[model samples]
Target: LWWCPTGLLTLLPLHAAGYPDPADTPAGRTVLDRVVSSYTPTLRALARARKADAPATADRRLLAVSLPEPPPGGVALSPLPGARAEAAFFERAMPGSHTLRVGDAATHATVTADLRTHAYAHFACHGSQDVNDPSTGALYLWDKPLTVLDVAELDLAHAELAYLSACHTAVGGATLPDEAIHLAAALQLAGYRHVIATLWTVGDRTAVDVATSVYTSLVDGAGLDLADTAHVLHRTVRALRDADPRDPTRWAPYIHSGA
Candidate 1:
């Protein structure tokens, strides 16, 4: 098999029907054919050249665990209070029914909690990708120190949506399990309906602001047909981009989504 990074990026966009779902057209097939053709050669060459073993993603099937029933003390969903008094203009735009978990920085609890229950989950934290050691790429919670250990244990099956709302958790490693962006792949493998992650860093304030707007729109029922968190995140981030294109902080976090 051959490997071509260009295909997943360019072909998917040129042929996609929309976010979370790409078009499976002749063009799409061509892209896929190339990816299939490229894989074997890419792997063999990389292994031979680098002399480094790649991570295992042999279980190509997405984790299809049935959604776990809400257990006792399932989730503690709450909005960031007091801070609301000082909410940026973006905060006021938030509508009702947006079940968010807010803290000084509660990324870990929020993620762990969201995995256990809920149709939608949002997070604003610091995340990084590891091109060299794909498994080490991880998210940095506002409150907790994020590591691969945490993500490895997450039950992603119940999570219909996961919005990383931070920098580059979307990128996939080169190998099957090695997509440098393990977060998205892992979420897909764990059976999440959708996982939305970023490819680069964003300003903390900007991230919170974008998340505020998008989740607000979602809670108001704008994403009725949206199948993936990436769609919601894309909409939100794009709005921010339009609001201020010059803000490198806004555009840097490219989407690495699995829908």
Candidate 2:
């Protein structure tokens, strides 16, 4: 079982703890480099937007944090949402003094604290699915993991944006009969204005790069509308792979925005 690196660390390795030498491996380096480039500007734009939106005297700020490693190849990574990108993505995406909360599942208390306090949240992990059964849809964590039902229970009010970098969190269109099993739709109805999710089983590696970059763009208003966000991400990932339409999986499957 091999797990990939993504999330904030997808942009910065040094700032990210628990993870190995992400830049040391060829695949790791390529992902890190792409995420760093895509999110650098997005981060700046987000800070500017946040600053203007903040009320005078409000101490609103940005905070990016992550665990150590990705899921071990064949094993589940704790069944909670966790991002694996570079930490720089956060440092740059949200400028100004930021809080850093680093810990494994052993420190579930740490992750819980940050989620309750942070304004932005990013979760990149293995998202389980069975379009026929969303109750089964869950985010895999490296250590401490809260189930999807648990996520539904937690009041994610302070958090403005949640990037669900997982696979098939939203893929229950014609397949299911009763109700669609779309994570984004469910989250939005739950009061989340911006919810970034996948429409199908995206390549873990490709999802790592595409989601990190797109989320960055959305943060900066490059594609505020969910529809635009989905299009830009689909096109960007395909462009990276050279637009090989012959290979559907290479340039297809991954879709988002409006269900």
TM-score top scorer: 2
Clashes of each: 20, 30
Could you give candidate 1's per-residue lDDT for residues 153-223 as a string of tens digits?
77544344555654556555555545433565555444444455565555555655665555455443322
Q: What is the C-alpha lDDT of each candidate?
A: 0.43, 0.45
Each candidate's TM vs. the true structure? 0.52, 0.56
Report the Cα lDDT for candidate 2. Answer: 0.45
Please report the candidate that would top lDDT against the real structure.
2
